[model samples]
Target: MTDHNQAIRDDIAFMRSLAEAGRQAPLKGGSILMAAGLIYAACAFATWFAASYPVSPLFMPTLWFGGTGLFFVALFALRRRMGAKTETNRAAGLIWAGAGWALFVIVLSLMLMGYRANGWWIMAAICPIVLATYGAAWTVAGILTQAGWMRGVGFGAFAMALVCAWYGLEVRTLFLIYGVSLLGLVALPGYLAMRQAQRAAA
Candidate 1:
């Protein structure tokens, strides 16, 4: 076949594989519902954590969690699409996805603990690590998936955290709160929902 015809064939095969995969799954509608739950948890936690430290400057934490909410919202929506389509091509996506959450946890820990540093020092230390883990996961999701948005939100969170550090925000302990509000509430559950569907579809 010609290259263009071959490409079309490949797309058709991909879709057919998905249809076959979707036939043997547990839950379909719940992915989006679960995402909704996760988002709620994140918002509630963010509110709680932010209130506890009314006087502290957790500007980064605020932005981080806020960005987190958006990311999860997008992720959940994306999951709904994939799950509703045929089979969720989530097997590879799930593997890398776990690593992404792990890195987020680590970054938030450091950020909340008030370890803000100077110059390229922070990026040199943290950025690569975060990128390495999250990037791997996003790559598995493929360029066409929601990986780009997740990567973008993650980078935004990191940048905001760096700025917060520069201004000397009190990040200690608050990182836990931020993590709770952000990942636990958002990414973790969102990851779980999609992963659950992904694995089922796989």
Candidate 2:
């Protein structure tokens, strides 16, 4: 069988084991937050569409959008807090890796200023550098929690980075699309899938 099919089977087996062990408790918190993200995306798109004005995804929206993601992160922590355990070390690895990326962002913002020749170049680099750092975190987190779905997300991020380099979009446009599309599109769904998988295992 192809590796993809094998991986799916393994994931299924893991879920079955969880179910058999009665660890499966539905995590509605993650689901509710994801649904909220979709709702917000729909509202944003509609608002932008009706107004005939492009909405710049700004800092406030980022805080709200990022807060939604943080909600899921809390769900993961809560699950573990409530006695959930990962058979693989991937979860722990991913957590530490996430921390690494957060630190990288702080450092990068401080250091990269004035280092790059053009302001647009700096903007383009931000997405990829952040995402690559994030991928590095997932890589260190352990392989089980780090799956192909995440690889795809990383690639999406890398693609965004390339686009940033090629097109040099305004920071506002980049923020809007990245938050509404990348996080909303890639990170949010990946988070939901993880939660769903955990739920099924329960």
Query: Which lDDT tens digits does candidate 2 get at residues 1-202?
Result: 6999999999899855544432323322234334434544453344334334554646434644465466557556645643444444334434544554584575456346735654533544544454455454433322334345544654555565555444344544544454465455444954665576566766
Best by TM-score: 2
Return the TM-score for candidate 1, rounded to 2 decimals. 0.36
lDDT of each: 0.48, 0.48
Q: Which whole-number lDDT from 0 to 100 does residue 66 have in model 1?
A: 76
lDDT of 1 by residue, 14-86 (tens): 8656545534443233354345335544554554466466545556456556757785776667665753433
Check candidate 1 and list the clashing pairs: 112-171, 112-172, 113-171, 113-172
TM-scores, all models, native as reference? 0.36, 0.47
Which residue runs of candidate 2 sit more than 4 Å off their true CA positions? Answer: 1-82, 90-108, 111-124, 136-146, 184-186
